[model samples]
Target: MDRLEKMLVDIRAFVAEREWEPFHDPKNLAMAVASEAGELLSELRWVKGEDADAHCREPEARRRVADEVADVAITLLMLADRIELDLPAEVHRKLVKNREKYPVEEWRGR
Candidate 1:
């Protein structure tokens, strides 16, 4: 299987092992996602582009970013799995919508 599928499987196993699924309601998962995103943003607070990129390459910074990213992904995957959402298909659909919304030619100027 692909990396994402493998990761999802691992996440499922993790949740099952901890018996945390019962607490992973949509609202709680959404909050978890937001909280993790905020933590990720905190890493770049007041940092410029180059500095932020450099920070991301540091082992400690990378680990922090990875943790926040995993947290967000886990919550999202749990919510999606609970609701039976097809993640890859939805991602492609959203990409198509985004392409339509921000066509290259029109957006190139900005």
Candidate 2:
């Protein structure tokens, strides 16, 4: 299987093992995504934009940020799966729409 498929399979197995599918409804998963994103943002709280990269570069900070990022991704993926979304296709479609709205030539260096 492709990488994305494999990742989804693993996530599915993980939830199955934990008997978490009952709790993996789209609404809850979406809320979990937001909560995880908040955690990630908290890790960078008070960090200046210029220093944000360096702040997360610290080993402990990086690990914490990575964990929060993973949580957000996992929850998002769960939500997408629960809603029967074709994520890659939706992303591509959005990108196309965005490109039309913000054409590169018109938006460059903005």
Best by TM-score: 2
- Mind giving the per-residue lDDT tens digits that candidate 2 earns over 3-109? 87888999999999999999888888888999999999999999999999898899999999999999998888889899999999999999999999999999999
Model 1: lowest-lDDT 10 consecutive positions: 70-79
Cα lDDT of model 2 overall?
0.93
Which of the numbered candidates is closest to the native, going by highest lDDT? 2
lDDT of each: 0.87, 0.93
> What TM-score does candidate 2 get on C-alpha atoms?
0.95
Write candidate 1's Cα lDDT for 1-110 as tens digits: 99888988999999899999889888988888888889889877888887888889899989989988887788888888878889999999999999999999999979
